[model samples]
Target: MYKPRINNKFHKHQIMMEDPCLAEFIPETRLFTNNNLIDLLNKYKKVIVKPSRGSLGKGIVVITELGTEEYELLQLNKQKHINGLENVYKYLKKLENFNIPNIVQYYIPLAKVYDRPMDLRYIAQRTEQDWTITGKYARVAKVGYALTNFEHGSSILTVEDALKSSTIKNFNIKELNEKLNMVTLSITTCLSRYFPNHKIWGCDLCVDEKGSIWIIEVNSSPQIKGFLELESLLPMYQSIVGYKTLNKKKGRRSR
Candidate 1:
């Protein structure tokens, strides 16, 4: 009888940051502060503001460059102008009051499907030898929506369907799967070195216009309820519990 384990996103992030394989994919995330926000805006004319530990794509803002002296903020499906540099600071301060950790990210203009932003959720599991990809779902941001999360009204589509509609269609299905698996494997291998006991992860990936994959975010304790129909889903569920049971038995033996 195996019991599953839950992973904490913050703890995993701290561990992943130390991993050589994942270090490059990890962004230079900083705690949200008026000064930091201003610095980010100055460095990149366009940046993304998002909750550090948020799920389902809630509380995301995309600030874009209007001109050398002007900028626009797209927050929660609404766009507004930041009158001046000082306003950027003020807006960040207001967000801080919510008592949530937020970070400024370099915006990656993700490729679109059906005129909506598209991203991939790579579900992975650890086996006796290595981490293996169990499933991959394509998430398409709803029309006019800022976030491409199912909870944000986005629709779920097969990766094949998504790639068909993408502007970059040079990649065949086999190539795409291989590319995704390689990236996910690299990231998990690195993260596991620091937290060897953990078992599951969901890597959020985006493809740019050039057909290159960029890691948007890494999620621990990924939601698997929606993937029950996937061929690997059952094995993943069993492996989770089986690993926990084996770990407990080993602890007892050591004692």
Candidate 2:
């Protein structure tokens, strides 16, 4: 039997947009083209160009407007300055993955913890009837970086710990926590409609400087070692282990 999982980022975005309730969590994403990149940049001033099928934060580019007719491109934690939008487009197009499908999306000004960007991973597993949030944890990027991958010098923390020190100012922690749960649950529920046999989902999400949550992407197979390594996440981590044990009895598997 085939795995009931989707890896194409563009397709996942299309389905997430279908739900009216998810409109706030979905960003403006378009296929990567010089024209599309120009248009997105014109509107958002900052955008991300990433491989549609890539993961682990590899081959992702963050483009920011530096000044009039000037742009900065950041990749793998290093950045360069380009003189004009045309030049920026040309540089990106010369990359090896340029000819293949990629996506250009609005660059979220992520809520920061001590000037380092932070985002979360929420794991939801299907029970007999509905999806349950099994586990979650936040990733804080190393100072002066864009992507938040644990393997790329990021540090993991409980969501509360990271946000408490955020520059977002005084806010209700409980309410903000609920929003994260709701967004991930809604995303998993929406994705299951397309891949019904899929029993688990790992959704990546981030909060903007405005405190609004954005669903980054859904993973069919998320890395588990991050959860296992964190002492503060022991409870949620055990929940995932329990879910795995239960799934084994039912012959459910993942890829």
Residue-level lDDT of model 1, residues 54-144, one tens digit each, is 6766677888778765788876567888777677667756763346667777787778988888888887776566676766777888788
Q: Give the per-residue lDDT digits (tens) of candidate 2, residues 1-255.
A: 233339888888888887987877888999898899999999999999998887888779999998899999999779899998989988988888776788999988889887898998989998776899988888999977898988888888888888887766567889999988988888887887888877788899988777788888888888877886687788888888888788877774553
- lDDT for position 159 in model 2: 83
Stretch of 10 with least lDDT, candidate 1 = 1-10
Q: TM-score each candidate.
A: 0.78, 0.92
Off by more than 4 A, model 2: 1-5, 252-255
Q: Count the clashes in each prediction.
A: 0, 0
**Candidate 2, lDDT over the whole model:** 0.86
How many residue pairs of model 1 clash at the backbone? 0
Q: How accurate is candidate 1 locally (lDDT)?
A: 0.70
